[model samples]
Structure formats: structure tokens, C-alpha cells
Target chain A: MRSPTEAAAGADDLAAMFGRHARELLRYCTRRVGPQLAEDVVAETFLVAHERRHRFDPSRGELLPWLYGIATRLLRRHVREEVRALKQVPHVPDAGYDDAAAHRVDAQRDVARLSAVLAKLPRRQRDVLMLYAVAELEYAEIAAALEIPLGSVQSSLHRARAKVKAAMSEEDNR
Target chain B: MSRTDPDLIAVRELPPGLAEPSDEAVARVWHKIAARPAPRRSSRRLWVPITAAAAVLALVGAGIFFLRPRTVSQPAFTTDRETVTRVIGDLRDRAVTAEPVSVGPGQVIYQTIHVV
Candidate 1:
């Protein structure tokens, strides 16, 4: 068993890890979901990471892959909840921001377009793409983070990449 | 062009532009975790049951004392109806005595006096 001092050091290391990577995690969340909910999702991801630090393998040279995995799962849940909520609401005209100039329609359009494409992908594929493209995890790291076989990671990533590319090309053609 | 060709690569992997977490974010998280009080000492929590039992015992003793029936002064009487009636009659016949009698369910005479 680790000594008390060692355990405390471990906890501090976890905190330092989170302090280092939280912003990137937030950006990934913003890309997967939107900017408005990114902070909450990132905070929740670190909370889980802190609570589950015992599960981490220190032998891994880096912690970002695991942290990204956690953030990916959280973003998935956030997006699903958002989509479910949207299904119940009627569409309405966009209101001007309280400041009237900051809430650009272009930003809203981009968010809407991304949301529509993300909502249609399989959950596994979406997770793979988000981790690889948005969070930028390597294949080996993604495999370790997801706890899946290496072969599975490669195939899933390939399928996810193909889907995202097709969707982007289709949007461009229109 | 083949889909995987380098020149036709539609998706570009940008350099990680991640910045350090804001001081405010770090401080907020650290403060929350640090402010959590240590687990209560086992000795203190162990005293809870013992203290509770002692309190319960004291309350029960007090309740028994307060709720116990009280002794009140009451006049003694004979059990024999015939003897009681004879004695009552004898007293009534002598000295023009007046004795208390029950006139209603809970009401009683206020005075028993002998008058000449």
C-alpha cells in the first residue's frame, strides 16, 4: 500500500493534470456540444477523474487521453439531453442578444449545422471522431482510453472519418 | 483522386492550441476540494449512540415520575349496604341531624349539620 505522503502526492498530481488540460478539454467540449455548455461539461469530467484516480495507469506517459475519454462521454450525454429537449420545443425566431450586437446569427447557424450532423451519427462513431478529430487522441491512446481492442479502434476511427468527410462534402455541394 | 491522397486531404489536424486552465478555474476547484472538512473522528461519532441511549433513559425516568398517579385523601366507608343504611338512619333520627346525599351523578350535598 502507498504511504500517506505518497497518496497525497498522487492527489496533487491529479490536480496538476487537470489544471494543465482543462482548457483543451473545454475546447473539445465546445466543438462537440457548444460553447455555452462546455465549461460545465469540462468541470464534470475533472470531477469524475479526481474521484476515479485510482483507476488510472501511471505507466502511461500522458494523462490527456484518459481525460479526453471522460470528457467525450460527458459531451455525449450533454448532446443527447439537448437533442431530447429540442424534440419537445417549438421552433422560434432568434432573439437579439441582451447587448444586441454580440449574438451573431452566423455563430448560431454554425452551431445548428454542426448539431444536425452530429445528431445523426452512431454514438460509437461520434465518440471516436470527437476524440480523434476534436480532442486529438492517437489511435493507441484512444484504444487505451476506451478500453477496446486496438483493431476495433482503427476500424471505428476509419468509419467515423469517412462519415464526417462525407457529411462535410455533402454540405459543400449544396 | 484517391480519398486517402495527401493533397486532397479535406480534414486538417490543427496544432493543439490549448492554454493553461485559468487561475480562477483552478482556484475555484481547489478551494471546493480543500474546504471539504475531514471525516468526523470515529470517537466522536461512536459517542452518538451512547449519548442517545442515555438521553432516552433520562426522558423515560422523568416521564414515569411525572405521569404516575397521585394519592388523594378520601373518607373510608363500610362495604355492607344494610349496615350503612342502618347507621345512616340512626344518625338521621338523632338530634334532627342533616347528612349529605348524592343528588346527581357527580354533585353532592355541601353540609351535614345537626340542628335542635
Candidate 2:
């Protein structure tokens, strides 16, 4: 506790960072991969974040983006696993929702199709789109996270969305 | 969903109940790491009023670090770059592909991230 270096990384800073964003990052990891691998991915993310906590420039952006960048890097290690799980489209977590119609929404078919389209997107586009739609990250946050220019973030999101739309439309017609 | 872009609709339909890591999982992760290493000089600050302002934006009990500042600088954080970089370098090596994912969208973006 008395280490001169450790003082820079107060437990409050690490705890503050983790307490603030762990749940959201976990859920994002779960959706990207699945529950089985999600914990590993999330755990690795925090471990990396903790080690790199010093490199984190709060002035560069909020911590979530940096966390996402780390999480995304970890996810890349298991991209094959992620693709496999997405192909399965596990049952929606909220089984108790009131709407019978929600149950009938054909999530399996749609997610499977989306997964395939996502597989084909340029890695940047996919990253941007996933951060935008899935993580609900703002453009600036994504720019910081992905470390691309703000313009690139917007363009990648646009391209990614267009490609996804095209692919989904193809599925609908089929 | 049908009325929206099919892609948007499909993703939007995703239920929010994704499973999260348990506290036990978090503890195990924490146990893996030893003490925080030495600190290198970093270009960040924690102006008190900014921290308090960032806290006010909290939803529930959660608060985030607000990168934007309305005040002058505080102390530069001493970061442990050597150790951290090695750890991430290991991660990059362990990665399935040998590409730098932290910076992508090509060389321009990669250089920009490093330069900034």
C-alpha cells in the first residue's frame, strides 16, 4: 500500500473504474460472444485495463472507450469462438417478458443473418458498428476507443450500417 | 422492427438481459494481478470541480471519469508504460491474428492514435 507507484493507482481509482463500467462491458461482451466465454473476455479486459490503467488518458476520453478498446482486443483473440456462438443465437435472456409477440420476433433467424453480415464487414466497420449499435457508444467515444479520427468513426458506422441493411434486406427477400 | 431498417430492427430486438460476470469471477481476476507497478509520467489531471461535476452525471451509484475539463491542470500521473506495454504486447501476440487491433481502419488511424 505504501509503494510510491501504487499511490498513483489508488484502490478508489481502480474500483471507481470497475464499479462504474463492469456491468455494461460484461453485457456487451456477452452479446458479442456469449455467457460461456463472456466472463473470460470480461475478466481479461479488466486485467488489461488495470495494468494499462496508467496509459489511460482520461483527457483522451472517458474510461469506457479505453475499456472497450481493450475488451475488443481480447474478443479478437477468440473471434472464431465468437462467430460460433453468434451462429447459435442463444435464447433471449428475458424469457418472462409479457409480450407473446416479442417471443415470436424470430430472433434466431435475424441474429443469425446479422452475424453472417457482420462476419464480412471490414474489421473497422464491424468494430464501429458494434460499438455504435450494440454498445451504444457515441461517435466521439468510439473514435477514442478505436483510436480512429472522428470522421472515420462516422464513415465506418455509415458503411457498416449500409452493408448490414443490404444483407438483412437480402435475407428478408429470401 | 419490420418498419425499421432490417439491420437496425434485428439488433434492436436484442433483449437486454445478457448475463454478466459474477463477483466471484471479478475476485478471481483481481487475484491474478499483483501490485500496481511503478508509474511513468502521464498527461492527465483530476481537477476537483471536474471530478465532482463528472460525479453529478452518474446514473444510479455509478460514476465515470470525465475526460473533458473546465479547470486548469493537476499533477501529471506517473504511468508504468514498460510493464503495461509488455503485458499488452503479450496480448497482441496471443491474439489469433498478428494485427494491431487497438488502432485500426488502417495506417492513417494507427499513426494518428500513436501521435495523439
Candidate 3:
């Protein structure tokens, strides 16, 4: 059990951690969502981590994976909010294809393609894949961040990897 | 390159030259983090002055309300000065209730019934 003093000290340390890692976390979120939504998601993620810092285990390898987990949760919430907001408007795109203008740059084209494929995956599978493949977190760390059984991580990772690979290949054929 | 292998481990990696948050983005995040008071310490510091000012004002207001006597509402006598002094003494002889209640600034009520 932590003393009140220890908890207070932990909050200060977490503030420092946020300052050092927020940009990297924002960059990571941008690759998942579009750049337009990245900063808001990053800010919300850290604010959440700050409020829940007591749950954070300092024994954990690095704080980045934990922040990624928070960012992933925020991204899902962002997507759901966007969907609800767009439902009011007419002519929703079939696959959430942002206009070509948004994907004009070569790198953004790749990101847009990848994002479209990612949007098709089940939420669980997309999360597992992003944490494992994009954030480069190990299976154990991903499980801890997600608070799920380790075996589930393995299964989700396999399914997500297969789907993304197939999608990429099909895109190449076109 | 095995272009046909869709089931292969696609090695999803960060693309080269992926867009990073600009220097401005980093600065904005840093400024926010820095602007926040180191958690508990900052919250404590922020409340101290506010709490102190509230307490001081409360004490000062209470002292002013209880200390001053109600002179404005006292009756003025048009009779002779001696008779007025005598009447004031007689009014003082009766039990006068001077309990203060809130009404407005610079005004009060004092009720005294002369027992004949």
C-alpha cells in the first residue's frame, strides 16, 4: 500500500514522464488516426494517465507502451464520436475514405491506405496489432496495457497481421 | 521480393520519414506540461492564497458587523434639551433588545419599549 506522500510523489514523476514522452506519443497517435485528430487524442490520453497515475506500475519496463494503450483507447472514442457526428450528415463515405486532398503526399497516401484497412478490423484486433507492430511493444506489455490474457494477444495479433498483409497486397495489385 | 505472399509476416514497421509532430507541437506539449504545477504541490500552492484571503475577509466583516452601534435609527427628540436627556435616561432604563440582522449597508434597527 502506498502512503499518501508516495502517491503525491508518483504524480510529480508522472508529470515529468508526460513532458518527456508526449510528442512521441502524439506522433504515434497521428499514424493511427489522421494528423488532424492526433494532438487532441494525445492531450486527452495524458490527462487520463495523470488522473489514473496511481494505477501505473513504475516496475513496468517503459511508460511509452502504457501511454500507447491510453492513446489507443482515446482513438477508439474519437472514432466513435466522429461516426456519431457524421451520422447527422448525408453521404457518409463507404469506407471512411478521407478525400484525396488529405492523402496528397506520398507518405500520407500510405497512411491513408493503412488507416482504411485498419478501420475495417474489429476494434480488439486493431488495438492488438497497433500495440504490437506499431508501438513495438512485446506481447506481455500489450497484455498488461490491455488487461487481457496473454494468449488472446497472440490470437488477435495473428488475425490482424494476416488481414493487414492481405490488404497491402491487394492495394499493390491495383 | 515475394509479392504474392499475403500471409507472410508483413513486418508492420514505422514507415521511413513518417510525419512527426513539428517542433511547435513539441513545444506546445512541453509548455502545457511545464505550466501544470507538479501535481499535489501545485494544487496545494494554488489554494493557499485563496483560502487565506477568504478567511481574512470573513473575520474583518464579522468584527465590523458586531462592533458598531446603531446610531442612525435612534429617535431624535424635538423637546427641550434637558427633557430630551431625561427621556434618553428613561429609555435606557428599559430593557432594549439590539440584536443585529442583515438588511443593508449603513443601517440597523433598535427596538426599545418604555415601561410606564
Best by TM-score: 2
Cα lDDT tens digits, model 3, B1-116, are 23223332232433334566897876666566556654453677889999999999999999999997877675654769898898888877663654546788877777899953
Residue by residue across A1-174, what tens digits does model 2's lDDT show? 134344334423766666667777876777777765766777667767776776776556666778898888788888787666655555445334567755555455566667767777777887787787778788898888988899999888788888878877776785
Model 2, C-alpha of B47: deviation from truth (Å): 38
Tens digit of per-residue lDDT, candidate 2, span B14-92 = 4334445577655544443334343433434546767777777674335334444467668664478997798889987
State the C-alpha lDDT per candidate: 0.62, 0.68, 0.66
Segments of candidate 3 deviating more than 4 angstroms: A1-11, A80-114, A171-174, B1-18, B31-116
The lDDT of model 3 is 0.66
Residue pairs with backbone overlap in model 2: B40-B78, B40-B79
Q: Is candidate 1 or candidate 3 better by DockQ?
A: 3
Q: By DockQ thresholds, what CAPRI class is model 3?
A: incorrect
Candidate 1 lDDT tens digits, A31-79: 5554446667776777777777767775652567777878777776776
CA displacement after TM-score superposition, residue B10 of candidate 3 (Å): 7.9
The value of fnat for model 1 is: 0.02
Which window of ten consecutive residues has the lowest lDDT sum in model 1 chain B? Answer: B7-16
Off by over 4 Å in 2: A1-12, A88-107, B1-6, B12-116
What are the chain B TM-scores of all models? 0.30, 0.17, 0.29
Candidate 1 — which pairs collide? none
